[model samples]
Target: MSKLEHAELVDGVREELITYLQNGTVNKQAVARTLDITELGIDEIDRLKRIHFCLSSDVVDFIETLQGRLRRIKTANQRDREITRGEVRGGIDWQATTRVRYTESAGDRTRFACKTPYTEYDIGENLVLKKLLWLVHSTVQEDISDINYDWRREAWPTERIAMFDRIYARNVHLNRIRDGEDIRVTRRMLNTARTARQSLYTDAYRLYDRYRRLLAGKYEDEDVSQLLSNTLVIPERLPRLFELFCIFQLLRCLSSRGLRLQPIESGAKQLAILESDQYTVDIYHDQNGGLSFHVPLSELEGIEADYIDRYQNVQRRHGELVDAFLGNDTQPSLFSGRPDLVLEVYESRAREVLTAVVLGEIKYSDNQQTFTRGLEELLKYIEFAQYEEYLSDLDIDIQGLIISDGVETNRDSPLDGEVTHISASDLISVGYPESWIPTQIR
Candidate 1:
């Protein structure tokens, strides 16, 4: 095949891989079935297989982290409730206390009372302990379900299967306790639970290590080192993962500012600003309005009106760009693009609302070509946002941030004094900018 044909083939396979990775319903088998393995050479087939394996492994790791966090949060909340209820139900006891004399009793010279009071067994502690046992059981059950459905069909090794079986049995024992079939919450049982959890972690790490070893051994021609360096392992999922990382960091920053943001419970792609039903920030992948602030419009003065009008125009243009980016009407070009993540701050108090938007492009690859392209894309986004009419009249500021795992350039590239470049680690470490984010919506 010619260079063009080979490039096309690679692109096609890559697109299919990305789609399979992104779809919630699609699995590895589906992706494998779609690819014409017979048409590809041995090397190509191996590369594709390695990519799929890495992607699946990364996704599992991501889910495991999420599950652990959710379990902890749920366990803590449940424990708290159980503790409170237990405390209320089982009042304090005066069993192990010294007697104290009170002065001036009606019939007797003095009355005696216990100096210190305490319960024989801390009911709250027992209740919380029981809840923790239950949590472990539930978490294990969840893992079992995931493994049975997601990994059972995969061609994993015998040792991996044995590891999973061990994990399953350990959980089954704890789950029985949760069901009250074998009612026990002893120190031994707690130790068993802790040991089981540690075992599970060890098994998971081993599985991931196995995949890494396989990739490293098989893909000799490719830069396997770069692949190993990827946090998510899969290149396709990097964008989504990057967005989530940014959102997580942003939430942490917002929490420090006394603002609480929680994921919307209804599975809607948005986060709720706690205590307010009217405000929310929507999340999306590789498009404008990924992190959008929806607020009511406030009344404004003459200068504010100009800002609002210009901001509206920018929004209109952004909408158009998004449509083009998502559609095949226009070919991929410098002018036609969308940011990997967009954060829009809306002000709504009276009537005439003003808005500020920050467009961020994320590059997970350390490849020089990819990094350069990311910079170019960011420059285009900034240039598109810098309208002379808007710049002069609008209070709205459009800032462009290019966040890359490795960027080639060192110099400052400014478009209307709005563009900035930073390493992905720095962005994650520093979190959302306090200076950039407004304290109040109005």
Candidate 2:
């Protein structure tokens, strides 16, 4: 093929990628399945490890809620501790106290062996929680060099990793649980835990059972398989993967700010909902949500009109772009070709009113033409699509941002202040403003 034909072919491929990504198919799990952990860099491996841990939502909830559930797991009256002072600390075993005295036949009268029964904690079933905590803590605290996939580490960012350190610290509930022969767990012991008759212990027992099962490498969940199975790797051949990676990086950064991943319904195509009590960011992969494609939009209330609108209805209309695309007979989503990602940011506290929107078009190409084409689409989106800040306070504004996987070219737009592009790698490390989010919550 000639250069013109080659360029056209390449452009055709880029267009198809948007459709594939937008069709509810390119989610975290799907993207994860395409990952080859061995081929990734150390930081990227750590990044995957973090996302992998989260892919198992059950596991995330289990870890976060486990300690709180350990209530019914009170100290048991365990009776087999050895006392060093000949005096019986709990009960005297004359045999134990005197046998050692007699066996040595040395004049060591100060040392006495006694049978001590203590109630501080038990090593039978009660110790299972400690053992579980120890297992997770040790795995998380391992040096990156020691990562051999024996267990996947939850390498949270610095502060959060320190937070995990505190939660996993043995001293938080009792002495640090050290691994040893004494910490051994048997099948009988696990069975005893699972069969606990008390309702109060139900959650605790269930969590412990999962902990034991997970540690044993019996991952019955497909999410866990995606995380641990070496063969279920992301090959380089997967298209538009960098787009997903860029989004994951954004999610990770938002996560560092107390935003959490909300569970999507089974078979749901939503990429994710990064939410906090104050805000909700619903991210869609390569679908028309804001303007053309499908958006899993939540019905919201409390839409007070632009408070100023009560005085004067100053209206704004997206002009030229509207003239180009809008028609009375047209039906869209109703379907238009999907944008790479449609992020609907909402003020969840205000009846989940939309506050901001991020209409994104990802181009996994260094080709100037490809980059320019994607950038033009985004600029056009800004022209026709206007998401208002409906709080009646902040002025509605429109801006654009590009997040990429290290493709460098001039992205300056002559029509506006900026259609600034950012490297995906930097997004992982830095913070961004709410204004950079073009569409606002209604």
Candidate 3:
């Protein structure tokens, strides 16, 4: 093909890419499938195949000049020679920690500072979040909205378009169709891609969390409360996200129990999260130690928004009221050093002398059937809980209960013989029975 045809083909490819990305088909394989292409080896970036490709002389020159400056900085600093402001002009900060000073071969120095919360990890967490968000945003705008398979048939060069057609047939399995039937794929394929994308997205988040732990090691001597706030972003906007995860376990548990929750706190006026009576429930807790629950009437609705909004609101309000409710000496759970949860239960009068003090740890996963590691952590906590009280002074029995979200209670499952999984959903279905929750037992 002539140069003009090649450029046009590339341009058309770009248009198709931007379109499919908008409709959530952001993967290169997915894009190739829509275009019916074979051997869509991703090179450079996904858009390289689409847009007109030209390396401007000016751009090339700029990159070469920057690289030369970087080399000079290395050479100048090699012989224990002083890097004066004049020698290191226009330079990018290699360390990326404090003030970023870039020095070029010319004697010019420009200094810029980024005030980041991170200190030890060198803003790795921030970089991860920024990169992931940018990737997601670009994918949504470019690939998701512009998906139009019909356009693949019209106004395109034979070879490139045929490549996309072939890809679509192979990956999407269009061969099963009858002679006259059109090639087609389902939303399931798109969903599978989405799931894979989400899995990768979580890796970014987990790596960020790892960066946080690395930073924690550096601030070992600092107060735990201060260290936690400094590392983790606060005014936490999503408490119910974690709660929702907990509820999923709770729901699975309820399913086994063969029972469902009824509408209890489903009213709009009573709960701010209940903006509507959809398939979601909204439960509320106040920082002032007040608690209210919302019950949804049905299923097949958005539970995430309703639960997250209400829980986050409570967490926020709690911060303001916590000082008054819990004495000044009381550690706030919002702080890093504070306990994850505090349950105040009315003690049973019949048990005057407590028997044993135990620490409980909870684990939820497929791999660890038994919470042995949790038991170890609880042992440490148990020591702290009982350290001061001698056996004679101890007047009540306390036992630690480690809850595992992934423990299988099903007698049929391999875990049934050993690991015991508690159902959070079943507990909720039972109206969050006080006895069921050890922390809340009175």
Candidate 1 local lDDT, 302-405, one digit each (tens) = 44567777765665576678787885332222234566656555443221343555666766555677767877877666555533333224676666666555
Stretch of 10 with least lDDT, candidate 3: 285-294
Pick by TM-score: which candidate is best?
2
Report the C-alpha lDDT of model 2 over 1-442, residue by residue, as the tens digit.
Answer: 0122223323333332233333322353444343444444333333454444433445445566555565545565556756464455666666666676677746456556655666655544556656655545554465332444422344334444466566665434445333422577667756766666653334445555654443343445443343444222333433355665556655655566676776555455567776777777777775545444321112112445576333222211233345568742322221124567777766773534565556677665555676678788776665545343222234434456665445564543334544667654355455433334443332
lDDT for 140 in candidate 3 is 27
Q: What is the lDDT of residue 140 in candidate 1?
A: 33
Q: How well does each candidate superpose onto the true structure, as a TM-score?
A: 0.35, 0.38, 0.21
Q: Each candidate: what lDDT?
A: 0.40, 0.50, 0.30
Model 3 lDDT per residue over 1-442, tens place: 1112223223323332333233322233322222332222322223422211111122123222322232211101122222333234334333541223433333224433222222121122223433322333243234322433333212233443344334324522122222212212233423332343333323444432333332333223233223222322111212222222343333333334433333222222211111112122222211111111112222213566777666656655666687678744322231111112211222232323233322234343333424456545544443334323432245534344445443444332122112123433333344432222222221
Clashes of 2: 15
Off by over 4 Å in 3: 1-240, 243-339, 346-360, 386-393, 409-421, 431-442
**Cand. 3 TM to true fold:** 0.21
Worst 10 residues of 2 by lDDT: 293-302
